[model samples]
Target chain A: MTAAAADKPKKLVIIDYSGELEKTWATMILASTAGAMEMETTVFVTFWGLQTFVKDKKRITGENWMQKMMSFMQRPGASHRKLSKMNFMGMGPWMMFKLAKKYNVAKPKDLLEMAMAMGVQFLPCQMTMDMFGLKREDLIEGMGEPVGAATALQLMTEADSTLFI
Target chain B: MANLDIKLKVDASGLSCPLPILKATQGIKTVESGELVEVIATDPGSVKDFDAWAKATGNALVEQDSADGKFRFVLRRK
Candidate 1:
């Protein structure tokens, strides 16, 4: 390989907006794999995604009876029903936690820790934090300063790959 | 026989596509060059995922085995 090509770093930007099974899995995979490739990775959590990384919030594992029942009902090819239930009185996040546990998917907090251990950069959106009355300390540890959407946009623009989940 | 011995195991069982590959990638990073990382996963998609990942990342797939809904692979880091 050419010297320049060998020296160039792979950049990955993962935008996490959903606090669901899909979003968490996508973020963790990208962070861990890209980090392994010695790539520079940045995970930007915005809006509802912030809950996944908040220190005060524990990832809800679907260990409860109700959650277990919900999982049984939502099968593959049941997207519409799943989406509808997700929007029901904050059932979405609860169900997400249950599914994550049922599937053996790593918890968001664990994923964040793994990302940090792997040297992935984690950023929270400044606007969203302010709107939600969240302080920097409210977030999980190892996170850098809250950045604006413009910064995230710039990072995405410069990335080799970008995913919104 | 000693020369072909591969060490390192990552239990990626119960994980889905991209996760198995992703975990294997991370496990390989913690080892020295030329060392092998064995990934054990239950995802049906892992067979193809590992093939694609090995190609994309310049790693060599030394061995692959599947049985009872479990898939295993040994990857040599380049």
Candidate 2:
């Protein structure tokens, strides 16, 4: 093998498909950790995962009124995400956040911030966004650009490790 | 080593994996190539994390010690 090939940084691609807070917490941690290791890391946000990237809660109304209402009723932004199990109507994430805090575990929001600060790429899935009727304006800042499944496919193909969460 | 005059000392205590390494790596860039930086962390994962970090970042893990589950690491920036 060529020296250049041996020296190339490992690539990590994480596909985030759910909006559960615990799952998101792990995803961001992995992204930031890989990025800190000087690896090329990309987190592909799709489907329900897109909820965590919404900047404006009210503007998330998708194509139809029902979808809009559903989106609006759900959480928005990094901090408001809920856990999938034992959500207790949102108390589960709160308790988990407190527990994580007590144990000095990095909060999901802070992890995401660190991931961005460390240059880990955040790629949004275009087809999922279209299917959900989400507009570009609905997303949070620092979301690099909207890309189709091809981007995720390429990342998965080239990555040394790929995680689906 | 304790005798190594560290130019930058980071109290990464209470910080988790990757953060300790992240802080150390970020701090390492501020010093001269050969200067030393010390890190203290509570995360058990830091032991191996710092080793991997030093390797990946081209820094040298000059010294490492652990006591009471706390970890101490010194690196020479390169």
Candidate 3:
């Protein structure tokens, strides 16, 4: 590699499509760790992944009836996420939180904060927002501008490592 | 060992993977170049993590040892 390229910080791009609690945890942990490692990290959140960034308690939002129903069913926000398996009627996330605390692992919310503090970028998908009828105000604060597939692909091309979660 | 001057001491015991390294990264920055930053962690994975971090960041892992289930590392900032 060229000297300039070698000196450049490593870049990590993560394309996240799932909003399950475990998956979101994985995305945040990896992104935060990468940021800690001094890498340039960006997460492209699309489809269900965008739901995780939605503001808490704004569960019943959307422009139309169908969109509203989709929002109601999914219940936007990271705090309301369920595990992909062993959810056990809301018992899984509770148990997972307990285990994480005992092990001194940061909660997903805290991890997200760390990632933000460390300058990890979160890019929401514009197309998904339109399809889901989600407005910019519905998302959590400090989100990067809404982008599309082209932008995501361009970032992936420049990144040293790309992850799909 | 007693003569070594440590500029920063981070106790990361009971923390999980990446946290210890993150703490080390933060601690190393607080010290001047060539000064030592020591970290104590309980995570088994910290051994490899610190080694890789040192190599990747150009910091020197000057000392490392483990006792009573806690891993310790001393790094000199680049």
Note the clash tally of each candidate: 1, 0, 0
lDDT of 3: 0.88
* lDDT, candidate 1, A1-165, per-residue tens: 223335567789999876655556567766776765567899888876765665544222134565445334432110212233355754775687677778876654555566788789989898877665566765667888889889999999999899998
True contacts preserved, each candidate?
0.26, 0.36, 0.33
- Which candidate tops lDDT? 3
lDDT of 3 by residue, A37-87 (tens): 778999999999999999987968789999999987878898888999999
Give per-residue CA lDDT, model 2, range B1-78, as digits (tens).
346798999998997665787788678878998999998999988898887776765668889999998899988876
Position A128, candidate 1: lDDT: 72
* Residue A57 alpha-carbon offset, candidate 2, angstroms: 5.7
Runs in model 3 deviating more than 4 A are A1-6
- After superposition, the stretches of candidate 2 with alpha carbons farther than 4 Å from their true spots are A1-6, A56-60
For model 1, what is the alpha-carbon lDDT of residue A33? 65
The number of the candidate with the highest TM-score is 3
Q: Write the per-residue lDDT of candidate 3 for residues B1-78, one digit (tens) a residue.
A: 567898899999999977898778778878998999999999999999988777666678899999999999998887
**How are the candidates ranked when ordered by DockQ, highest leading?**
2, 3, 1
lDDT of each: 0.70, 0.82, 0.88
Interface RMSD, in order shown: 4.0, 4.8, 4.4
**What are the candidates' individual DockQ scores?**
0.29, 0.44, 0.42
